[model samples]
Target: MSSSETRPDQPVITGATRLYAIVGDPIAQAKSPAVYNALLAAAGRNAVLVPWLLSTADFDAGLRGLLRAGNVDGLVFTYPHKQAALPFADVVHSRARQVGATNALRRRLDGRWEADMFDGVGLVRALEDVGTSPGGRTIWLVGAGGAGGAIAFALAEAGASQIHLTDVEADKATGIAVSVAKAFPGVIVSLAPPSLETVSILINATPVGLSDADGLPVALDDALPASLTVVDIVPREATRLLDLARASGCRTVGGAAMVAGQAAAVLDYFGETAA
Candidate 1:
């Protein structure tokens, strides 16, 4: 059947289909299954992506069990597990190595596993799609966790002149800055409190905008500069930050863009091991 005609309720999974899963503690909120299933169908691949809700205690055993299933070809890792999943991989890509996290994994022909991270790369691609390039731009990035750190590294790699990282945990931001500075000697990387002044781009990689009750990542009394570009990686169609940025006359990129950009890279990675 053509991809356009395929319904989510009627996905043609069977005994011969190859299986892939996205693992997370609270898996219900993940958009991976719907996004990936459509991609697989569009690519004419006989594979399915499912969600596996696993707690911290069961993660290792559950993942090992999945890997042992001959039909399971790969797994995607999410919150509370991206870093933990790294040790299980036989090979770690340079990007994941630098970020100290892995968001996707694929099985190789030799029965070994390879892992890589796409969070930063995906955000960069999303920015580029909208005609914004990090090259020579000054960026103030908040939240130096897995996603934020990956993005800081990517921006530096993409030729950003300067990056100021900050998080609730000062050490996490400092650590990410140290790694980025070491990796890109020419780029200026430092840790600082979040601010909008003198920065061409502002990014919030935190969970602050996930709910209406959540506070803004950065305080704003009035409108921001029209020249500023704001981005939030909260995986929502319209986050409070994005809404505020729009009202303030600043250009904005929402979480959906980041997800869409990463979805392509993720599906391509999965296809490499498709049965």
Candidate 2:
């Protein structure tokens, strides 16, 4: 579909009606609809950012339908479905496979769905926005789950000298550390708790700040050096951890920056220039 075209009233779906969706469970919390829809509108695109709230049990059927839908321009995979969406892609980006997740899907010229993960790249872009490069920095990443794993790998690729991964499940954290170390053997890797010392950049990948979640992702009571750069992947306007970081005189980056970067990247995949 052309960017300027509008859908007909009570009309049939066709190849001309281009579509896009962000798949997740309990998708009501997602800001993708607001973020991407704004970008699409600014770019004068006919696309819409619809939410596909699919359960794990419904993943296969939902994905098949998306692939078969001729108007589906692309998709943004989120939350629990990041890993689940990997196998459906005809071409998986190397970074996505190594991180074991994907957040973007593009329709190839040959009519095959190609998958790519933008979380890590977006995280690095967010970090750079705060005036720090992951390269040559000692980093500590909390939460080795899907988002954490992607962020860790992205940090390694961006030149982090050493990365210490930590999670409630030590194995999950350490397992990712192993994969990252193998991917970049020159970088030091290990599992450990969050510490202000020796960490130039700290990332929180857990959902600790989300509504109805437990305490801060990290212990905020402890003193953090002013040299530390804190990045939290929580989209709230101002998270408690971010507040603490501000109070401690540390440079801070928000989840919204990551959201912005991802939205810009996804629009690029949709063959539209970001506004």
Candidate 3:
């Protein structure tokens, strides 16, 4: 047998293969194609996930085009598309509804799109990997977009004691805080400026730290305590935030850990192996 056929993770596409796509405006940077394709292959699925560079203006109609494809099984969304993708789904799952966004969309056997957000679950898993848990931990979370909202809800569900939310747009922060607080009444969720005091964990959920020119999402006045854990969802392993968090004497979790944590959960939701 050929190496591609023998290797479980190597995809061997055929006419019977199922199709999937990860859509975003700048789809080139998306990691889902590589991540999801490998997961699908390892699950013994004859499927392939590809990147779709759909423009923001074209998102709604463009997505309709994708779903119309009979062979397309599902889609993964990133950036501007996550929030926009929610309305396209026939069923908006509780996870997506609570987060105000959807990151994964699967077509039902009945031919309807079902969607949910997994970014927060990914963060929760990432936190747990380093012996940290959101439960009973006070967190200062920066960012209130789709992913930000998702993270807030996930943290709340994981039993975070308190989640202090902030965003450049104050209302966005308030939206997530309100939704999460309402959904998880036991978890204290509120909008506030990022602060180090009393918070055991700090997370940068925004894109601010993704670029070299971007300023640090939160300005720490001094070194953090050993009790505090810092996480930045920017995919770069060497983001200045991570470096600063390490230099400032605290635990640091990078974006890859979050991706690794979410991969299996995402596949489970996508349901190739389980299906």
Candidate 4:
């Protein structure tokens, strides 16, 4: 619709100015810049990922400008903007199409935007990195919002035998559960908070650990089974819930794994694999 491009206040020749960025309404808290900068340097690329703040009405315009810039290879999309970027892409990866959202956008050789959704793939990949496989494993997932829904879908696709999803919103949880059951007919699906039983994996996709949100998404009375692999998708440096899970002798994965995995996928969308 409308676009704004970033350029030096004055034109200058430089070899260190290749560009990448993460787009969102509130970019202040994003860890992408820190992570991507390190990754780029590790790869010996003259590029960095920065934060871009744009209003909902301006997302399209802001993205157009970013893609048109010669220096920016791609941009990672974040909350409130991921679903909106879909129509602008010339190509939509299958995951994005299935999820009805795009979390990464890259500029093609033809100069058109192509997009993909990587949250679920990232989660599954991160789990595998920690020696846990969703296949044949029973997983209990909390929160059925966008990230949670995507995670549920990924687990189903990864051959999870059973999945139980819970959200503050019953309808949302029910909707995702139905979708999971329909998508993977053999997988058992249910609604409600997870019971501390034989579930091999526990995933918390809610923002409870963030913003000082009181109460963990999983119930306090719940004792995490030592055999269970736990993952929390909150990107804070440290989280009490994750600490508790570890202190209880459960194998735990932090939010950073999900963030790195997602960033890897986003980098892939830019046609560059992680080093």
Candidate 5:
């Protein structure tokens, strides 16, 4: 799939079409449908990726039902489901093995599901596209959840100098910090609050800012420095944080770019991208 062709518009669904679902709680914010459907159309593939709003409790049953369907080709997991989707896969890709998360899973012809993670790679690619490579840059990442943890490791792998992490669950953030620190001994990882003092990049990897009621995920100064590169992976064209960053003359990359980046890789993984 060419990421350039992806849009939210629904494509023609037919009896012969294959199916893909993006499973998660609070699934309204997902861009996978928009990102994948357009690509499927562009590639001339008879497939569609839809969103499945499964609560934490129903995830197992919901996933089982989806997998039971013969035409359901693959699944794109988000937020809480990334780690949860791992055990369902018979084969785990190296990236998923390293990150301990699986954001995308494909059904093999042999009737087994294979899993892999691409969130961190997508975020890294998105940052690089905006000329804000993570290498040697100190970063403050919000959310030590599935996507955040993967991004943390990927940043370290991309040669980030230091990473400061914060999450609603303190233990989860600490765990992610320790894991990243252990894997990339050269990169410094800290369990710190959101502070722009020594940080050149601030990333919101959580779903905190999806609704107006959620407000800003992290508080920022009245005027942010232009040197900071702010990224919000909310999949919205504009989140309050991104707007604030833009207002302050800081470089901002919204969640759409990250979705687009992942669309390229994950569609290829699904064998839906055109050669």
Candidate 6:
């Protein structure tokens, strides 16, 4: 027999293949499956990443059920589940622990779970990819949830001169500001209403512009200065904020850039790396 024929078969889906899943309430809208599956294929690994549409009411039960499945080796948490998945993890990395949220989880050899947050790192990398650094820049960030909290901490770590965090729930923004300040004492972090007056970069970390019907997160009467760099984490390459920013001549970064930046790290967490 030829050497190729002598080798074991490698089908797309097999009994021995490892499985990964992204969990969220509105799982259908997630863009992780395509990106991660492509990474898995490039890595020459017999693994697949799928989406799990889990509701809040069934989150705990549904997650436990997935853990029971022998083939499920990892999970990516989104939206309402990021913070909720914390208690289930046996160990949490420093970043996730500091942010009080996790976006990725992996099964350790000892049958325990290890979790980490990558949103902030991804955002910073995305900005860096476009030749912009948060260092010494004044930033206005909207939303203070899981992704926003991570991004806020990341901006500080990137040496941002000041970070003003805003959220519909004032307390949430304040809470994140406190955590970020404690972690990076040299970085000026505060809770403030979203404004672009003195900021070099403006970021939307909320779901404010996910659909056409959604309005802009920040109100603007005229074109913003071309010096401002706008970023949105809504997963769409042409989010409304990005579109408006581009129209106004501001340099813009979309959600896809962040996803791309984080893909390598996420694959590494799954014990897989793209070739």
lDDT of each: 0.85, 0.82, 0.82, 0.78, 0.87, 0.85
Q: List candidate 1 segments past 4 Å from native.
A: 1-11
Compared with the true structure, what per-residue lDDT tens digits does model 6 show for residues 1-275? 23665543332778878888989977777777777877778778888888899999999999999988877888888887889998899999999998899999888888888899998998999898888899999999999999999999999999999998989989889889998998899998877654566889999999887777988887775578788999999988786678778988988888888887776778788783211
Candidate 1 TM-score versus the reference: 0.92
Write the residue-wise lDDT of candidate 1 on 68-131 in tens digits: 9998888888776888899899999999999998889999888899999999988999888877
Of the two candidates 3 and 4, the one with more favorable lDDT, higher being better, is 3
lDDT of 2 at 231: 89
Q: Where does the lowest 10-residue lDDT sum fall in candidate 3? A: 1-10
What TM value does model 4 have?
0.83
What is the Cα-based lDDT of residue 211 in candidate 4? 65
The residue ranges of model 5 lying beyond 4 angstroms of the native Cα positions read 1-11, 272-275
lDDT tens string, model 4, 1-275?
Answer: 11246322221225756677788866676777767666666665656788899889887777777777887778787766767788888988877776667778777777667777788888999999989989999899998766787888899999999898888888878877887787789899988555677689988887777766556776654466688898988877567678778877888888788889887667656755222
Model 5 lDDT tens row, 2-77: 3556535556898887888999888876767877888888887878888899998998998889889988878999
What TM-score fits each model? 0.92, 0.88, 0.91, 0.83, 0.92, 0.92
What's the count of clashing pairs in each model shown?
0, 2, 0, 1, 1, 0
Model 3 / residue 152 / CA error / Å? 0.7
Clashing pairs in 3: none
Better of 5 and 6 by lDDT: 5
lDDT value, candidate 3, whole model: 0.82
**Model 4 regions more than 4 Å off:** 1-16, 55-61, 64-70, 272-275
Kindly list the per-residue Cα lDDT of model 3 for residues 1-275, writing each as its tens digit: 23565544646889988887878766665565666767777778777888899999898888889989988877888777888899898998889988878888988878888998889989999899899988999999998998889998899889999999999899899878888888889988867664576889999988776677877886766567767799998877877788878888789998877776676777677774223
The number of the candidate with the highest lDDT is: 5
